[model samples]
Target: MTTSSMKRSQPFRSLVNRLLDHGILPTRKLILLLAGGSVAAALGALAGLGYALFWLYNAFLLLASILDWRSMPRRGQVNVARILPEQTDIGRELTVSLVLENHSGQPVPYRLRDDLPFSFERPPDVAGVLSAKREIVTYVTKGSERGLYTFSHLYLRCQGRLGLWEKQAKLAYEQHIKVYPDLSTVRGYLQSLQESLIVDGKKFLLKTRSGTEFHAIREYVPDDDPRYINWSASARGRRLMTNEYRPEQGKVLTILLDCGRMMGVELDGRTKLDLSMEAALTLAAVALRQGDQVALLAYSHEIKTYVPPGRGLGHLHTLIEAVYDLQSDFVESNPLLALEYLHRQQKRRSLMVLFSDMENYLLEDQLGAYLWRLRRSHLLLLLSLADPLLHDWSRTAASNSRIAYVKALAQRFQLDRKAFQQKMTGAGIQVLDIPADQLTLTVVNSYLEIKSREAL
Candidate 1:
């Protein structure tokens, strides 16, 4: 039989092997017994036989420890299983349980330490006595990174009945868990959107001249668009009436996530890519809820993942699963390649939002033409994370020559960024350079604005 099979079927035999191969450890009680023996030996020395008494007591202590070690239940007599959540958000605490079953016909005192990934917070060691058929122990731990993690062997130490020795055994219980990006803001955004719609018991109409679909006819207000005045309704009602139109639903929203080397740069403990993922998922959730199809394209040197446009709230889960474990590649990204692939896959006019580094895009002079051409058929919006450090540098006073040089460079970069923004605006491409913390909210708002304007 295989090693694991042997362990499962012949636990007693495995315990026997462990008993012979593994050394017995002294418990606190055993050490106390040894200390008492020493005291007794010292007293015997007062009676003029210290060495003999010491040897005699040592032999008795050794015998008692051996018996204690052998009295403990075998490995086959106990079973252990670990329970973990299949998925969790990064930095969120999750409970881990260890269910232990003992069939040794007696109580077993155990100390357990699970083998966990190094990236996770250290878990507390569990110690308990199992007197019943089943005993459960739980602890809380959180993962710091986003990826799949494994829990392999669990080290179990069982104390003898006399509490003189502990026999250690390794239980093979493996479990997999996936950690996803923190999406705590998604619910808040949805709640805010819902609240925004209900003001004084009236649903706020998103009035826009660009909306083409007819919705309802309402009494004309002072600021109502003159172009939407329904002449027939106004004449029949003998009052001025205006036509209402809601933004088109089932529109397409494409999110392009850049996973290049530059995206690996960390700001405020989170990488740029990490922040982008959070924003991307939030945007996707908002778009899906609005009855729009959402697609994702994560690329570095090559496309890491591509999820075709799909509708419904369930599609958010698919997008989360697709990019939960995606990492920033060491190589630079090819935005053109990703866009080309997306163009072929998505022929319909869609809103394309690119989350990438501004500096990288600036380096690719030819990329502007491609984005401009794509804008002819699609609504293009480029979002980049603005580093706060550069902003601070640009605002710092020139206290030294080195400081002046750095400030000059920061100012130059800012100027270039503004120039690029203006150039893109002239070419009908929207651009936003925002801080990481505000990226999600800005992206969602920008999308809403585009939809209201019927930009797509």
Candidate 2:
């Protein structure tokens, strides 16, 4: 009704009128009417009046169709706009709305379909009779892939006044949305953030250790350490009080993400790279919350993305934008190149967490030396995803020759992975080989442990 909105709809209305001029399709009502008329003509033929009755019936049908077409409302009479969110997370449900304004004065029977992205489920057609001045229809959709997606062209069909034909129109409306990794882990952490120790899906009171920065002084509980009792504060407050020390913060954490062929392996319907990105995001959130500067480097055969060290919640948004559309490339990862680049750009000591495939690192024989040298300057942690299938295969009973061979191979791979982990640990490099589902928790805990130990 507003002048501004009416002006905006004018051009689209004109476009809709042009598009609706293409064709008209007969409706079921018209078809049924034709069939009944044919039956009547057959009966008239048996009565010896076939030719005249047939021609009369044909002329009547033609007249009805013409009158119906003239009385029908133009497709441009209804103006529609799609409302969509600018961004959403993978596997998260979102609501899409179609806002329709009817200016035709009469009711319009219409059906609509939106051109959704390939990763989204095809929503059923929307069919209804619009009699109101304005109406809004909404549908739920979820994206399975993480990337940018566009929705274009809303296909609409409207029935004529006499229900004889349906006019079709293709209206152009484009909307672009970015799909990011799931943020459930980050949200859960924030909800229970007051609790210090999170272990295996459980929260526990933090047992502050000595030789750390003082966090706060709280009323002493039975579980409070006797050595941490604040005698002066206790006397002044007339109650037992203890000094709580927290891990030192303001350290730099560098997340080295490997988007290569190996990371593309699928597990539990999600790629390893997807899982890694989620874990990386969780770690970055935790570190940034602790007032640590977080940096990100995503690379495959070459550096795909690099976000310099930054702090605060704003930096987290920067990281999300840089990697939300990143995909794994079908090429070998060059850790050497990544390390050299990091060395050149960064000179300060920081904690380097590498999210990569263990097999890929093992295959690159020359990567060890570079990693060892990098460890001397920065605390290096390699986080790798363990395949559950391989673990299951290793435990399967060797009842047949084929089973025995598979079990042997699995065990061999496990042993090799374990030995490599030990070697890295002995060299003062931390490593965590966790399952896809457990990566977020394990990586966060490892970072916390390293920070507590003041390793960086």
Candidate 3:
């Protein structure tokens, strides 16, 4: 072996020597030999012959010690490769794969305990297993915050015969995984919408009306525009057509998210704030694609993140990154302050989308005035979470006092939701009360519907 190799092997050799010198290697064998020799000697005494037993005991002890020492396994070399997804979305499961290779020529039987990042938990099945080389697959559900995650160490335990002793070695491997705001579903929806606009001729604009911005003019029909009628051509028996106008481009869209105590409540597997953020990201993406300049604001008692009105793919990236790490405050969201901030920031008329749980008590107590002020300039759309678990519980309740109590609570919450919707509608606000699973889809549909109406 080279000098460097010998130097590297010296520590383990010294450890083995120390163990041998302390009699740890053969203590059990020594005790067994001694006990057998004593019994034999006692029997011999009764028979008046004792000298041979002592020689036999020494021979057995020597043999057993040599065997035990030889049976102990050596620590093997290890290599590890880690695989992870390129990017992960919040609230979705991401899989990480670990492959281990053993370099030792001997078949080293060892147990492996991979040290995962604190943010992740190992799936139950992987909690057990040991080998020289093995593969472990683990999953972690992404949280609201987006950032880089690193995994660093793999621990190995080597067992000796009889399971009396083990040698542990820690191997170091470095890897990083990037987490980004989820946008795949939104991109797919936009692609579908673009296809529909391109292939469907019936939905295409045919005629332009007065007081509307002219978009395009197609072949004239029986009831085509009179002003665009080319009267001289009509006298010549030729068809006439009018121009069609789509709403002027550059309409502003504002998305407001409420990150407050109500949004902090967890339902199913994620907090309401998490669902809202995902929905907001989807809405922003769709709006930007539709030629509308989009702005975003996240607020509770105070502003958390705000992206001023902008258009383009770069703006979308900026907005997503800005809100990725935002969290809900424990305090009640101040709707009055939020509206005032909106008014000050937005100078032009815009379509404003608000995501918040508009519980009746909170709205009546704190937000009534702000709602009035917001309606003057912006076309407001409010989106709220509809708790499915409460609905299911109410439907499945048993006929007992305990169940009756739960039913009453569910009914009250439902009534409160209704009141909240009614109040917003009364104030001319469009509201969407959707379940968590449907929030992204609902938001996308709303944007499309608005686009079709030429509102943005």
- The order of the candidates by TM-score, greatest first, is 2, 1, 3
Instruction: Put down candidate 2 lDDT per residue, 1-456, tens digits, no spaces.
Output: 999999999999987777564457788999998888878789789989967787788788899999888766785888889999999999999999999888889898888899899999787898899889999999888999999999988988887678888887788999999999987777676566465746446543333463388889999999668999999999999999999887777889999999999999999899999999998998898889888999999999999999999999789899999999999998999888898999999899999999999997778898877788888889899989997978999999999999999999999999989988898888888777898878887788777767767767
Q: lDDT order of candidates, best first?
A: 1, 2, 3
Q: lDDT of model 2 at residue 306?
A: 100
Report the number of the highest-TM-score candidate.
Answer: 2
Off by over 4 Å in 1: 1-23, 28-47, 189-210, 214-244
Alpha-carbon lDDT of model 2: 0.86
Which candidate, 2 or 3, has the higher TM-score? 2
Q: Residues 150-201, candidate 1, lDDT per residue (tens digit)?
A: 9998888888788898887777888999999987766555566552433223
Give the alpha carbon lDDT tens digit for every residue of 1-456 in model 3. Answer: 999999999999988765532223323435665678878777777877666766666676667556644544544454556676666775567776666565544344445555666656554423333344554545444534555667677665544344333445656677776566566665565566443432122232212243356556555677755666545545555656455555456789999888889998988757888788877887787677656899998888898878899997678888877877677889988666667898999989898888988562345465666766777887788788887867887687578989888888888878778877788788887777898877776776676666667654
- Consecutive 10-residue window with the lowest summed lDDT within model 1: 198-207
In order, the Cα lDDT scores of the candidates are 0.87, 0.86, 0.68
Estimated TM-score per prediction? 0.85, 0.90, 0.65
